[model samples]
Target chain A: MGEFDLITRYFQRPAKRSPLGVGDDCALLAPAPGMQLAVSCDMLVEGRHFLSTVDPARLGHKALAVNLSDLAACGAKPLAFTLALAMPGVDESWLEGFSRGLFALADEHGCELVGGDTTRGPLNICITVFGEVPAGAALLRSGAHAGDDIWVSGTLGDARLALEAFRGTLELPADVFAQARMRMEQPAPRVALGQALRGTASSAVDVSDGLVGDLGHILASSKVGATLDADAATGVIAAAASCGLGTEILRTCALSGGDDYELVFTAPPAARAAVEQAGKESATRVTRIGRIDAEAGLRIVDASGAPISQRFGSFDHFV
Target chain B: MGEFDLITRYFQRPAKRSPLGVGDDCALLAPAPGMQLAVSCDMLVEGRHFLSTVDPARLGHKALAVNLSDLAACGAKPLAFTLALAMPGVDESWLEGFSRGLFALADEHGCELVGGDTTRGPLNICITVFGEVPAGAALLRSGAHAGDDIWVSGTLGDARLALEAFRGTLELPADVFAQARMRMEQPAPRVALGQALRGTASSAVDVSDGLVGDLGHILASSKVGATLDADAATGVIAAAASCGLGTEILRTCALSGGDDYELVFTAPPAARAAVEQAGKESATRVTRIGRIDAEAGLRIVDASGAPISQRFGSFDHFV
Candidate 1:
């Protein structure tokens, strides 16, 4: 199919939130009064972001889900998104599966596809998502205070465990691998938890490039440090329990394993009940595994608050 | 350098307009009251949108320019943009030149770089640009009316001429080829003209995929037809005069050559003076090239009212 035909057949839809949709030179979206538009972009490349053998449907889901994770971090309501896709060729079955998975999640969040581009090239999926948050209400990374309790919504590090298993660096039984692989492929963005923590959380960031590194972003931006409970951190990864992972490997994956789309946020000690209420409200597990400090750098600690020696570097795309 | 460092060094800057910029998971942009956001995305793949031999700076400029051209078509004022880029590896010199060109055009248009993603892959540049226009005031392709005088801003098909020269399909003198190449590399978006023609022009579109094809979009969207003056269209190619090109080649390039990025608009016959005034206000040349009709398909004719004997097909990415 031609570019326009391909767009029309698979991607184009009747836009609900936008004034103008996919066919126009520009899509028009009007944020409601007292609302600010929250925008974020993510690009997924084959072999870098995903494996070549990945299901097209899951790839599409992960593409939008990662972008949605940004919105979740910001405590914003998703409004619309633009997907610019480049592919080696057009495969009808792949497009069908991809679009199905893409629109399924988008519809769940009420995020309309507003505008995008399709071109023939190496497989790449670039998505820019738009969301709405009330003025001055977004959860920013700079809001974390020294006395705030660092909380992580949902689990982490399972994706990285799956990656290591895929790379043959680790081994897992069939059932364990299946579960870990599912976590790697389909991560649920904690949108409800993020919104619930809009006013409660002092600061927030989605754990994309591992919890330690992403939390470090909050620390750096807020000019505060954190003392992370390494043992408690290991408790978040479900795969570790099934696979009988060792302490060192679990610590490594829990600290440096990337692609976890969970939110790592901070709230004051007095608001612990409020944070627990938010977790219940969103129906997502909330784990308190760290504490913000006045110190300058992140310090890893055990259950008894003793410092751990091993250093972990988070995943970096260019590096 | 790592991904974060690379972003900090080359892409991140103090955002002038956005509430939050690149450091965060999402960027926040608040539009003025009664304004609607205009968004569009374009993906440029190596060997598809541009030649690999082209300068990185110009490639960056063209990447943002094409997206801005979409905003211009809708008579939207530039706001902010997100760039999602993937490349084989990190090259400092290329990033320097690319960022230089990107920021130059972005600064000119007052468009802030809000947020984006960068990763390792085959070369691809995906940019999603945001603009704002008064609610219900965007010039849409569906706004055309029968008997509206079709107008084009600046010149068209010079980029196509340069492409033909590069492809060994046409010959041009050294100076002419240089001038055409500049047009190909740096086609300035008509932002000012689009803003000026906000109310004056009935309908509008940017001619990226040749005048005939792009104009066909307007005609199809408006459920109308147009009689394009082939002779007048031929007069718009600057390279024709410089190279002493034949009428047939001139017509073909003028009609079907892609990458022009000039505005093709429709205005009422009585709005002729207003159209001219808009062009003058924006310091752009306006040429009357056609007239909208009640019938449905685009009809090309000479100044003498005779239908052009030759048929031309617009450039399609996939054949």
Candidate 2:
């Protein structure tokens, strides 16, 4: 029999009124009254995402958190999540730590650790998070429109730098290493700011793969382009510089490097004031770094409107 | 610095809620007024779950169906599901088939494939399904009580037999081979039976790992014990024997086999009439085989009510 036949025999059953259940361009979920649904998932591997020597508790937490960031990105409040944990052994300590980390995050986020599966194989962790946005109000990547200013909520590249430090590739002073490693170890999700942007911002996505990569998703999905101000784009480097690091290196890390977990979004020019207002209230900086363009590709320009040459590219999982 | 820390830095977000959101034991959603939520997840691995030579479409479909079976097991109405797919390459045809298979099931079940992830790896899939159960009506594994009857829906051991055939340990006529392969390739989820059992059964679970192993979970969770009639347990073997299989081999296969995708449930004494009525209306066989016990461990009894010498075990991922 054909694959579809097989899947149908096993998957299809009685259903409620979901317009597209299990098969469609995308599944649409309408949240309950006064509640928004949170959504998140993470991709993990043996060598690339983790090492065999790493603690399991932390691994569990990290796996759950990656998905949590997606909820943060959508500005949906976190609720519950399922974990898909693949491993070669039944390592108790690892499971204990992983569950600890996962539940710790769940506790903090007011979410629950519900369903999951444990299969045998190389270590791969994939977690899907569920959150809620008010009915008909979840933020999407396609809401970005031309003339909307692009903004990112936090410092980037610190995670990548920490990765370097962990790998022993880039040397760091004690203080810088501590801070950078902290950024890499425990990323602070911008859930508060994301909630604030729900009605105010037009398009949004979490910075997962890298700034350029996630931003490109918004651009392509929205059928718009962007021109980043290199100065603002490299503000992360400036912060690194103030901490006695090379701006160019940190800029490269911020641009092309990933694991940032920040929210990069677009708000209409009219909403820029609201963003500023939100920044003041949240005590978190939301920098306007670029503007959506009528054109269909991305470009980087200086304040003077001159294009800036950069070597950064999107994160390619296959490549 | 470590992998887990690295992951958490990017993932944890704040939980906001209606009923089930992000940080709970499970995500809850009321897609429609008074409708229950469907829940399921699929886990895929590279070498174990699928062979590189297998059609990607089939792989994807199988991935989706496995989780849908979980929802079917729960007797909840299907709604939507999320997928986590990991691959080493991006093959358009593979993705096309995978999507086709997935969508076909979704369409048939009125479920929408709401969200998913694509990333680089050794190829693993994890899908979590969402469905709904009327308030206070979700079927569980712990509802079986003393004097309640044990039941299983559909044929069993076909998937395990198919696996054997795949490994070339078993030889069959081409038609039988095809049938066995069909059993493996596409399993019929007992959605109708599960739903029918919701109001009538005391406890239930979809048979995945193996009857014994999966049933162990029910017993453990329900904090109850069971005494299976070995003769009735071997009834499937007798059925196969009439179809030309040897009794002993068929018995072993039925006992230790996994991947049947059938629902194994317990009906309370008071619900027996309801169970038979529901089964008749649903056109699904509900076998009566055993009874729940006050004891705290599973027991296998012969036709004369004496303990059998045969050991009971099922598939374990680790052991």
Query: TM-scores of the models, in the given order?
Result: 0.99, 0.84
What lDDT tens digits, residue by residue, belong to model 2 across residues B61-87? 677777777876777777666666676
Off by over 4 Å in 2: A1-36, A51-57, A164-171, A237-239, A243-248, A269-273, A280-283, B1-30, B50-55, B167-174, B237-239, B242-246, B269-273, B303-306
Best candidate per DockQ, number?
1
DockQ of each: 0.91, 0.17
In model 1, residue pairs whose N, Cα or C atoms come closer than 3 Å (at least 3 residues apart or on different chains), thus clashing, are none
Chain A vs native chain A, TM-score per candidate: 0.99, 0.84
lDDT of 1 by residue, B54-126 (tens): 9999998999999999999999999999999998999999999999999999999999999998999999999
* Per-structure clash totals for the candidates: 0, 54
lDDT at A59 for candidate 1? 84
User: Chain B, TM-score, each prediction?
Assistant: 0.99, 0.84
Candidate 2 chain A: 10-residue stretch with minimal lDDT: A19-28
How displaced is residue B112 in candidate 2, in Å?
1.5
Off by over 4 Å in 1: none
